[model samples]
Target: MSYLQKPSYYTISLVVVLLLPFTILFASFLLPFSAYLRGPPPIAAGSVVAGGCSHGAADGGGGGGGGGGVRPEISILVGVHTMAKKHSRRHLVRMAYAVQQTAALRGAARVDVRFALCARPMPPEHRAFVALEARAYGDVMLIDCDESPDKGKTGSSAEDVTTGTWLNMGNKAKNRVNIFPRMYDFKGVKPEDFLEDTIGVHQLKQDLRWAQTLEHFNVTWLDPSSKMTNSLLS
Candidate 1:
């Protein structure tokens, strides 16, 4: 009777082997269920509202009662220095084309991208290129130092090349103080509230520092390199 009552070690081991897989499977299913039940109720309101807002704009219906409608307009200003010459013009034109194409692909009703050329005597070649490009896209404008009313007469002393003078002229022109900034206007559109120094390479560090000042004024500094467009799109 004692021998019969003694459970065989092999039998006990076999019983455990049969139950172990089931135990693990049960735990795998139950643990997640326990976590789901114990954790905070699904963040319903926050996630729901956020999702609604995101789709609302895409569906043309925002909280403002409009459904599946167009998004607000975005103004992009591409500022180029005269030293860039033909290269700058080509780069800017390509950028404008890309911007327009991107906007169209994104389903924007309108995307206004403009190039603001800042330099002295406005290169004749640049002006011609801009004119030709503008006819096709109407996204380029030439802003020359001579256009600034504050620019002194040609006969004056050797011409000031200081950054301060260059920036001062820009501020004045943008503010419509010395001259009316009419280089680019679309449907009575004012210039972009933000400004970017599209100068890179030549004076890399100095250009960056000058751009920093513009940033202080809440302007964005776009890299002058053509690669920037690709980076931005990516």
Candidate 2:
């Protein structure tokens, strides 16, 4: 018998043309199905996120036997009643409070120190300086009053009300006052009256006295590499 006849060129071309569309279709379906079998891509490392428990659960002692319970936060607002003319004093006072804001203390207590001023008449330069200071510090309040301390500028509770409105202290938490804990350098206060646990030292009208007070309280001196330094003491 003779060898099988070789396929003709026209027959081979016809076979390729008929199978072209089916091959393309099969490849399209197979590509996506293969990807599906491989499963969804992983989330980016930076895109991952987590959440914490609610304040109610945190404060109510959280779930049983969880030693990593959240610490209850204490919010304190220390309003320093000062005149608009005291710009340098304000800077010093800001440093005095800012330096004391240790990380450990900040983790537990949210202490907001604000300077309260009166809407009294002042020079244009003074007003501009006050505006600049307020913008820079974001902790100054101008109360609607124009009178000296003797004329009852601070004797009324208007400042307190204004402060409450400014701070949005309308929450349900019951407020308590502790004016005694703060150090007031009035004539009645003596050296022996200084307490190690005093919250603050008021009436520090003199820079030398302020430096001394801060030095006394910051007995545990700040770290050598610390950026926060008491310029007054320096």
Candidate 3:
């Protein structure tokens, strides 16, 4: 035990063995306390995304992350009723909406465009593709019904069943205005028909037709540092 003598291997091993458990215990207590001081991670912007196709909402995850900010003044949800087979058109429609999310629009209102699909009769391949697509876009809803436009299986407003009918009740009519020929276009969408004012274009089911229509409004991504290319339709 001379002060100048080098410690033996046995002595060194004994010292380390005695200190190891204490070191581990200190870390175990300190790690959680440090994490607690940091607080829970901030919830991502657009984390609560997607509306269900059925009457109820379907919970899922995966979306872009950003810091929180003041809620937009207005919130609008445009639900497009579609079949599961139209995958390409869905992508085009998503791109169309995404590009239109300009700085001005983001500041004033939050517009979410989600697709509704009938889930009952979906084919195996369609189901798999729809699941992946919903996960990727976070905007698809699967309706539990047969895929039929005439069956009225899509959905209905609960107010419709109330004793008071809106149509004939004069002043009791629902607080809504017709958007046709103004905010929405029900007519078949053409390439030249894509206008800056219209909020929606309907009946563009054909892939080529939809692509052409989107090409009219597709804004070219020009940032040199970014890898995104111009519209594929071009």
Name the candidate that leads on TM-score. 3
lDDT per model, in order? 0.43, 0.61, 0.62
Q: Model 3: per-residue lDDT, tens digit, 49-90? A: 454222122211211121145667776666676778988767
Error of 1 at 187 (Å): 41
Candidate ordering by TM-score (highest first) = 3, 2, 1
Count the clashes in each prediction. Answer: 7, 0, 0
Please provide TM-scores, in order, for all candidate models, with all chains considered together. 0.27, 0.51, 0.54
For model 1, residues 63-157, the per-residue Cα lDDT tens digits are 11222356445423333333325544444334433422433444533333344444465568865665554444443444444644354332233
The TM-score between candidate 2 and the true structure equals: 0.51
Tens digits of per-residue lDDT, candidate 2, 107-207, equal 66656556777778777887888777655555666777874765444655566566566456565335656577564553323456677668656567777
Residue 230 C-alpha lDDT in model 1? 66
Per-residue lDDT value at 61 in model 2 = 20
Q: For each candidate in turn, give its C-alpha RMSD to the true structure in angstroms.
A: 23.0, 17.0, 14.8
lDDT for model 1, please: 0.43
Candidates, ranked, lDDT? 3, 2, 1
